[model samples]
Each structure stands twice: as C-alpha cells, then as structure tokens.
Target: MLEVKVKAGVPIPLDVSFQVAAGEVLALVGASGSGKSTLLRTIAGLYQPSEARVAVNGAVWLDTGAGINLPTRRRRLGMVFQSYGLFPHMTAAGNVMAALEYLPKPERAAEAARLLALVNLGDMERRRPAELSGGQQQRVAVARALARRPEVLLLDEPFSAVDRSTREKLYQEIRNLRRVLNMPVVLVTHDMSEAQMLADRMVVIDCGRMLASGSAAEVMIDPAALRGVGLREAGSVLNARIVAHEEDGLTRLDTSAGSLLLPRIEGAAGAAVRVRIMAHEVILSRDAPQGLSALNILPVTVLALRQGDGPGMLVELQAGEETILARITQRSALAMGLQAGDACHAILKTMAVAQDNVGVMQPVI
Candidate 1:
C-alpha cells in the first residue's frame, strides 16, 4: 500500500493518494510538472512531506501522526528512474548484480542472469549499457530494480526512450515480471494511450491533485474529465481488425458492430487494432442513406443513453462485445427517437475518424 498528500510550494496545493495491490500496475497520468514525479519522490523518501504518509505492503514508511520519516534506503522500494540510471561501466548483468550485494558473488551473478532472462534479455546480459539500444537499456534498468526483489516498484516514464513497437514488447515483459514476483508497480506517464494500455487502473492528476481514479475505461471515457483536459469528446474506443487495405488509400476494418472503412491504414492484414470514433463523428439515421459518402454504416443497439457532460448526449452503443459512443444534440436524440436499447444505423464518413480517434491503429501512419 502507498499514500501521500504533499505540496511543492505552488499556488495550488498538490494532494494525491492511491494504493496498488501486489502485482498490479497503477499509473499516474497527467501533464508535465503536474507533480507526478514529486508524488513518486515523496513515496520513495526523496523529499520530506509536509503532510500525509507512505506505506508498503503493510509496513509504514512514512507516518505524519507518529512523526516518522525513514530514509529512502530504509524503505523497501524498487525505483526505475526515467533515465533508467544504468551504469555505463557495468555490463547489463553487472548492473543487476549490484542491487543484490547481500548474496554471495556466485549467487549474485546467477541472480543477475536470472533477472535478465526474466526480461528476455538473456542474450545481452554480458553487454554494457552503452552497447545496447535505448529499449535494451531500459530493460536492463527494470531487471536491475528487481535483482533484490523489493516489495514495491516505482517506474517514471521508463519507456520514453523506446519506440512504440519495442514499448509493446517491454509491456509484455513487465507483465511477465509481475507474475513471477508479486510486487506492486507505480508507473508514471503522460501518454493516455500508454497509460490506458499499460495500467490496470489510471489515476488522473493535475496541479498535484487527483481528478479521477478508476479502471482505464472509467477514467478515460468520461467526457467531463476529458473535457477538463481539453480532449475532444470522441466516442468510445472500439476493438477492430485490419481485415483489408485498399490501394486507393482506404482500409476495410472488421469491428464488433460491422465492417467499416477508414482512411489509408498501415497495419498488417488480419492484425488487431483499436479504432477511436468520437461521438461527434457519428451521424445518426432513421433509415440508411442509399447514396451517401459516409463509409461506415454500423447497425448498433443502444446500451445506455444519457446526457453528456458537454453539449451532446452520450449514447453508448453495442455492436457486439465492444462498445462505442455517439455524441448527439438533445434535439437530434429526441427527433431520432434514440432511446436505451434502441437499434439504429450509426452512420459516419470514412474519413471523419481521425488518427487520434484510432487507438493504437498502426502501420498506416
């Protein structure tokens, strides 16, 4: 368990707190200098907190009421800085071994090799950080943090140095590591896509205060919170597959609702992707348009219909197991007879869905 409520000498007080069950990843997501790093530092004993407390798996690391402030070393925590902080002189194996000094030299070496293997870097254990790519070094840093097997792991933008392709691989590695060692991880990142994909639950923070904390679905799809962050109220994210790509710069996608067409895509045929269709992009229809330019005509059943935080109503639609959002004005909703559990044709132009609306839609870019 971890908790904190601290201020960084700012006009708006920064106060946020959350706990991670062992092996689960809880992400801190917000803008730069939102004091996300400060929150992590406070929990790690890097800074003295004016208020609040820090604990790990039932042990109290910081207690304001008891006036206890343990040194960082005394706290049982594993830290992976944004820079990774790998030693240039040390090989990947050597860096991991340093964290396990309590063990014999032979055991330390074995442990290093084991941790490296856990992260799928068994082949590069002997190579120094300088010899490895940015992604490789970050993996080494993660292995090093686990050599001693601390109760908690703190990662601050650990994948910034890596590209999207490699980052997915690292995500899998982290998932594997969590399975092998049941330690809670605190991941700090600014990218919502990364945060949504990597974290089990997301904690939204701004000005050092917590805005929302819930599963990725609950935290991100809320138009109010997104509006607060200036994110346009796009509809829900739909899981899609690149069934086919056209030579004319359009691609056919197989979504839960039905087959749809979108702008030229770069994904391999038969690859899974996320398509973001904002509610505003979808145009409703009482009857299908016979000769319309709108490419996607999804036959959807409205799961829930309610007012949106902003100007439009939030219509949650179900095509299959997947859900999507359609934002429409109150007048349109009433005129179209849009009601909960109503079946309707959700119409949209193929080109209306922008790249941002497509979650992790790859290869086309």
Candidate 2:
C-alpha cells in the first residue's frame, strides 16, 4: 500500500492525502495545472514539499517531522512520463536493460527480454525508440519501469501522447499488466473518462486541494467531485459482466440494474466490464413510455436530487443496487415532480454508450 500526505504553502499550494492499496490503481484526477503532477513528483522523490509523509508498505520514504527525505534515485518507484523518455540510440531491449544494472551483465539481457514480452513487445526488442511507433515506445518505457522491480508504479498521463485508437489498446494493456503487478499504481490524468475506465479508485483534486477520494463510481456521483471533473463531463460508472454478443451487433451485459445492451464490446462473454453512463445521455420518465425506438429502460427510484445555480439539475437514481445519474433541465425535473424515493424509469439509447466508455474491469489483486 502507498500512503501520501503532503502540505505546502509556496510553489503551488497543495494539501492532499490519500492511500492506494497493493494491486490497485488510484488515479489523481484534475484539470491541467491543478497540482496533480506535483503530487506524483513528491511521491517519486523528484520534489519535496514543506511538510509531507510518504510511505510504501510501512517503509518511510519521506517524513518531514522526522527530518527524513530520500532522493529520487533512492526511492523504489518506477515512473512513466507522458513523453516516452527513451534513449534514441538504444534498442527497446537495451533501454529496459539500462535499468537492470543491479543484475549480472549476462542475466540483464534475458531479463529485458522477459519484461518486453510481458508488455507484448518481444518482437520489437531490437527496435530503437526512433524506429518504434508511439505505442511501442510507450511499451518500452513500461518495460523499463517494471525492470526496476519498484514497490510503486507512477503513470503520469502515459496515454495522452498516443492517438485514440492506440490509447484504447494501451488501456487494455495496463488492465492486463495490473493482474501481475502486485504493487500500488498511481495514475495522474486530466481526463475523467480515462480515470473512470482505468482507475479502481480516484482522488479528485482541484487548485492544489483534494476534493474527494473513492471508487470512480462514488466520486463521479458526488457534486464536489463533479466540480473537479467539469460538470459537462459528469457521469456514472456501472460494473457489469458481458453475457453474450447479440446477432444484431449489440452485446448484452448483466448489471445489478438488469441486463443492458450496448454496442458490441471487444471482450469475450463472461468478462467483467465497466459501462460508463453519461448523465446527459439519460432520459428520466415518470411513466414507462411506449412506442420508443430505444430498447433500454431501467426502472429506478430517485435517490436524491441536486440542483446547481444553472438551469440544469443532477438527479441520482437507484436502479436495483446500482446508482445512476441523469442530468436534465430543472424545468423538466419540476414538471415531472421528481424527488427522493420516487419511482421512475431511466431511458437510454442503445447507441449512447460508445466503445471508449467501456473498459475491462480490473481484477482485485
């Protein structure tokens, strides 16, 4: 587990505290220049704050009260930056081998090969950073980070440099890697959707202050956290299991709310997955509407209602044991007399959920 508590007055004020368990991915989410990267730097010992306590699995890396501070090289943590920081002159295998100085020279080559293959880059071991694609270079970086055998892994917007198609593939690769990496992984990202898809839990930060911390589902449902992740991007994440691929090109998923149909998902049936339901895409109805083209209608009970200064309202609903959110006009909410404990149905179009909004559920390590 990784425990962090940092407070500073100068150089970007930050007062954040959070914990991440082993085999868990905790995302630090906020807008650009929101001190997300600063926190990561502090944890990696790249930067020191006025006062802080950074520990990994009971080992103290930094303790202001104790006047103990470790340098970056002394910290047993691997970090992957947005830029694939690779030696252009070195091959992928060589880049990974550079971090294996502690091993016998003869054994380094074999270990590098093993790490490259771990990230599905065995064939590209000989390719230099200049010759490899962006995703491949990122893979090389990941291989090198893992080579350290670090106790914690720090990912700083690792996917932002890749294209959307490549980003999705990397996301899956990270999901696959988490199964074997038995350490806490911290990810810093401004993209809420990415955090929702990849992180087991999230720490919402804004203006150098921590707003909220919890599972992606829990943070997204909080109004305070929504402020950190712009209200425009607010949504709920539901855990589901892929049941089957329908003949009509949709995939059926079994959630607590009931079966949900979405555009064909990539994984095989029985795979656990997360479905992101955008609040703005949902339509609330007091009565089940007939003659609708949409096939997904979930009977839900209004859990709570939050209205902002704007003309819109955020409605929280309980569908079975799952919590869903809907963003509707305050006028519409009033017209329907929506309130806590009121029974209603949530209408969602089959196409509303895009492929990017779906992610493989990370197993609890």
Candidate 3:
C-alpha cells in the first residue's frame, strides 16, 4: 500500500491512499495541485508522508508509527520523472548503466542492453540524449529505471514531452514491460485518456484528497467526476449487439434504444462494446425526420436539456442506461420545438457513428 497524509502547513490533512497490484499499473489522476505528483514524490522518499504508512511489495518504505523512514537509496524502487532526466554527455546505454552501479559490474552492461531492447531501443545505444528525439530519450529513461530491477516503478507524467503517436507506442511498451517484469507501477498523470488506457484501475484525487478509486469504467462514468470536473459533456455508452450487416455494407446495432445502424464496416457478431457520442452528436426531433439518410432513430425521453458545447444544446436522453449525443443548430432546436421534459426522437447518420469511434477490449479473433 502507498499512503499519505500531507498537511503542507494547513489546518486539515490532505488524506490520500491507494495501491498498485504487482505487475499492474494504477494511475493517479487529478487536476493541478491535486497532490498527484506530490503524492508520487512522497512515495519515492523525496517527501515524507508525515502521518500515513507506506509499503511496496510487502517491504516497509515508511511507517510514521515506528519512525521507520527509509532513505531513497534503500527503498529498492525506480522512478521516471516528468523531465526524463537523461545526461546530455552520455550515450543511451551509458545513462542506463549509470543506474546499475549498485549491481556487480560483471552483469550490468548485458542487463542494461537487455532492458534497452525491452523498450525497442535496440541500435540506439550509442546515441547521446542530445542526439535522440524526445521519445527516444524517454525510452532511454525508462530503460535506465528498469536497469535497477526494482520491485516497484513510479512514473510522473511520463509522456508529456512526446507526440501523441509516439506516446501511443510508448504506452504499449510500458504495458508490455509491466506484464513481463511483474513490477507494480504507479503512474501520476493529468491526462484522462492516458490514465484510462494504462491503468488496470484508477485512483482519483482532488484538493490533495482521494475521492474515488475503482476499475477504469466505473470511476470514469461516476457521476461525481463528470459534474465536478465540468465534464458534463462526458456520458456513458453501453454495449450494443450487431444484429445484421446490410447489402450496402452498413452494420446495424440492436441496442436497448431499439436499433441503430451505422455505415461502419461490419465486425464479428456478438461483440460487446461502448463509445462516446460527444453530447454534440445528438439532435432532438419532435417527430420522425422524413427523407433523412440517418439510420439511428432513437425514441427518447428528455432527461435534462441544458446550454452546453457552445450554441449547441446538450440534450441528455435515455434509450435505457446508455447516453447518446446530438449536435443541432439553434434554429433546428427552435423549429423542431425542443425543450427539457419533452419526448423527442433523436436522429444521427449511421456512417457518422464509425466503429473506430467505439472503444473497448477487442474480441480475440
């Protein structure tokens, strides 16, 4: 368990506590000054926990009860900071070997090279940090951290410097490393998508306090985070069954809302999934839209309609537990006579709802 109770000279303690399972990554996510990075610092022995105990893989790193505070060196942990922190003069392998001085010299170079390959940084060893791209530097940093073979690994906004495409590749590499190494990972990040993709579970913090922690799906769709973070546009999408594939190649989905057909290419039947419809994708209709090419027509009751996403109104409707979106012009809103507490049909194009727009675990082929 990694725990903390920080006062920062305040009247009340900012209490937070959570743990990452061995070989699993638990992402710490929150807004600025939410104490996420601060908490990471505390766990790595840079800052004292003050009141709570801290342990990693059954080893006590901190215990305020007995005043058993372990120094940073003795903690047997590795960390990658937001800065990457590679030496400009040293080659990639040189940076990696720097961390393994604690090991016997005989095995250090080969082990360092092995970890570099683990991060797909093979043949980049001779390049200095100054000669490498931001992503390559990160790979060197990650390789260096793993060189110590620590039981726990902590990462603080590890991908902040890399481009989105590079970040995606690095994300996969980190996930692979965790699985193969079996080292528990604690990631502190402000990016929601990053947290969702990497974490087996998540711990949400705000104002230096833990607010919620659970599986990614549960925590993300929690009512509190949606409202608190001004993420009112965010809503949940439930699984829909693919009932049929049309001759025109459009795929039809039989959801609780009746049926929705999209021009997306067909996938295997019986696939369970979910996707975000960005409140803007939804438009209200007092009656059925005539001569429209749209295939998704949902008979929905207005749950709540509010001013949102610019001139476009946010219409929260129910087709069951799933939430859908419709972005309509204000003129359409007025002409169609839409309002809260109104029963309206929603219409959207089938082709508009791409399968790539959906996200979930892909079924094994």
Q: Write the per-residue lDDT of candidate 3 for residues 1-365, one digit (tens) a residue.
A: 44434444353246876766677788888887888887888778888755757787677888878788899988877899898989888889889999999889998788788988988888898999989998989999998888888878899999998987677667756755655767778898887666766677877878887777886655644546544343533433545776677788777667888887766533466654444454445656787788876767889887665554455555567776665545456667777777766888977666555443454333335
Model 3 residue 32 lDDT score: 73
TM-score of every model versus the real structure: 0.78, 0.95, 0.70
Question: By descending lDDT, how would the candidates be arranged?
Answer: 2, 1, 3
| Candidate 3 residue runs with Cα over 4 Å from true position | 1-13, 232-365
Q: For this target, which candidate reaches the highest TM-score against the unseen true structure?
A: 2
Answer with 1 or 3, whichever has the higher TM-score.
1
> Lowest lDDT 10-mer window, candidate 1?
356-365
TM-score of 1: 0.78
What are the root-mean-square deviations of the candidates from the true structure over C-alphas? 4.8, 1.9, 6.1
- Local accuracy of candidate 1 as per-residue lDDT tens digits, 1-365: 55554544444457777888887889998888777878888888887656767877678888777898889887877889898999899999999988988798778888888889878899998899889998899989988888777888899999887887677667656654655767788899887766765677878888787888887667655654565344553345677888888878898998767898998765588766676666677777767668887778888888877776556677777777877777778888988888787888888888787654454333333
lDDT of 1: 0.76
